[model samples]
Target: MMKHKLPPIYFLHIPKTAGSSLGQLILCSYPQGSQLNCSLSQLLQMSREEISQFKCFAGHWGTGLFSLLDKEISSITMLRDPFERTVSNCLFIKRIVVKKFASNPLALDEVEDLKLKSDISELLKCTNIREMLNLMPSMKEQQSCYLGCDIDLNEYLGVSQCSLDTLDKSKEIFIENIIAQQLSSGLLDINEIFNKAKQRLDAMEVVGIMEQFNDSAHLICNSLGISTPKNLPRENVSPENLALGNLTYRKSGTIPDDVIKQIDELTVCDREIYEYGKKLFNKQLQTEKRKFFWFKKMFKKSERF
Candidate 1:
């Protein structure tokens, strides 16, 4: 029997984007060795020479993996609404980080818990669009400090005396500065990240919005000359993560009033991207309706004849 080798498929996992399910589907499609989860920081500790051989990579890479892979492998990712992404992140922190901390008596000091909870409540209370946008990542980062790998034993305990309040203020300013700069600049520098990955991978790229999953997957299947499944996997927003508030529509699902306000305040560049996405979704819906109408017309014509 001749051996068959499947080509590599790179999945770029963006956090809170239904990436794990997508990753599972890709893993099922490809042979075992071809899929790589790139999120592990331990991979970074490898010698530069050793790391060059890695081909396909995935996971919440924070733009770092773009510099690490070979150029030929196709890169794919899924994006979700930023507001929903923030909420999903919050739930993840509450369940994983908070629960773990509470379980470990040494990890959860009563005073620390009170302070962190207060900070989180204040963050959640933000109603102004600009302030909400500014607060989102800061709260996420604070949650990460508890859950993240970088914190040392000293930093985790009271002995270090790091003020979460002070840190939150500094983080808010830093995030605001970055957001302002990105808005004014009108382009994110993926060049450095891309160039590094390009050295090894022949192609480096991104996939957008979960709404486009089927089309995106079909394109990839066609390009690779692989069999596209009749039932291509769909991305589902978990029930627990569904939007709650005034923006809710029967078909479209709810988005809180505050979330919409935040979205409205997005910079021109970001707003342009969002509008483009909306257009694509609308176009897709129209196409589907036309197909349905065409089929109905054919059925009626056959009956009349």
Candidate 2:
């Protein structure tokens, strides 16, 4: 009998989705040395020979990485309700800034850029989600940006490793928007970006829903020809951080209706992609069920014979 080989997987991990947990399952399905989890900059530094050795590539990278790949791979990602994701992200950032700055008021000063320092400081004062989103304009349509934006492989290859190293430093951490820069600069209109993202999404082997995580995990396992685990790991859940206690950001029913309206406005593009993802997920689920049903029937017939 020939052993089955799984295709390489590229997990385009959009932030605030349950990608961390899904990533663990993916890594477990492969052998120890066959998994590589790193930032886009780190991946860019690898020679093709070095990169091809890994069976799994997972990270907070955008679709742009696709153009740089040396081999064809199965790509997968999860989509969340845009409003929920956007709000969760705002709360998470708020929690982090408070915790990090409370320990050292000077850390805000350490952020370097005058504008960024001002922004972080402004974020510190934000009494509500609307205020935070207003300060972080790049965060709007963020999900679409990840799925839509495609980089020129040649351009990134020419960039200095040192400059890329700076990206790894805190300069890009939690604040800088590599994907949003293109959108902010008007390199591509939001509609164009959303359409591209949806097109790429439609082509993915698995498009999981965060709300339907267990089923999503099962579908991913099916794609990899692996047995589904009895329990899917839940990692990096939005913490009920005490730091944001005064903000009440994570509590259910706490967000104001007007604020929700603002989130809806900001996530207009992301909202459409999310709805599209849901339809795709449902279609894939039905197909998987049929395959499973046939597999069971065949096994029963073979047992009688």
Candidate 3:
């Protein structure tokens, strides 16, 4: 008979979701069987014996890694508000891309005349969401200002305003193409992604939210029948950082009113996901309240009965 080995605890690390800090916390908490250096893909490729050795595995797990796991393994993910996440992602890119452009002598000339909307739209054209999702974008492009080789903003900047306008139109078309590809490929539809994620959450013993980090951690501890620690890593977004103008946190970028209308028309799936997430959060809150009340009642009855 084959011995049943315990599955590694997985922390599904989505980018920009405070995953790095969380991963560090998990490693500190379970240093014995923790493995932190490898990617999820690398972990998935390991043999059962190799997998059983690790008590915790934390890394970025993109959608593609979902199918690689066995049913016995527990999975956990931390989700944040999508709109806030999108803004964070945008700011991250800006710091890397825009900051570099600002520092470079040659790049300064181009960025000086750069209108935020046009520049961002152009960037979107060059680095479509499809390429990012597929992990096709080169490491340099991912890190640097240049999006793709074919859609260089540096070259476009030298062109006449008329030419720039044409490029803008082309960029829009490219964005549409990318969105179309996303729709076709099943990654672009937010509702589909959410539903799929929900299924994974149901399979998992725990699902957590960034907003309720401490409560979630306590719940996870109780579920695992482990002694809850007095202190865990606690990192909060500072008030100064939360305010606009801070590099770390900026005011949520406004999707142009027209563009929002267009988005409403184009992405019904995202709307559904937004609604579903809101509903799920509410339901979870109610469940937590009921559990708290029941626990209180049980505690009180234990002394009398």
Off by over 4 Å in 2: 1-3, 106-138, 157-168, 173-176, 241-251, 303-305
- Candidate 3 yields a Cα-based lDDT of 0.46
| lDDT top scorer | 2
Candidate 3 has its poorest 10 consecutive residues by lDDT at 140-149
Best by TM-score: 2
RMSD versus native structure for model 3: 12.3
Ranking by TM-score, best first?
2, 3, 1
What would the per-residue lDDT of candidate 1 be over residues 36-108, giving only the tens digit for each residue? 5642334443444454555455555433443454454566555555444555554454444445346667765
Candidate 2: clashing pairs of residues: none
RMSD of 1: 11.2
lDDT score of residue 273 within candidate 3? 42
Per-residue lDDT over 14-42 for candidate 2, one digit per residue giving the tens place of the 0 to 100 score:
88888899999888788889888876666
lDDT of 3 by residue, 161-192 (tens): 33322344322222223333454565534444
State each model's CA lDDT, in order.
Answer: 0.45, 0.73, 0.46
With candidate 2 superimposed using the best TM-score fit, by how many Å does residue 277's alpha carbon deviate from the native? Answer: 0.7
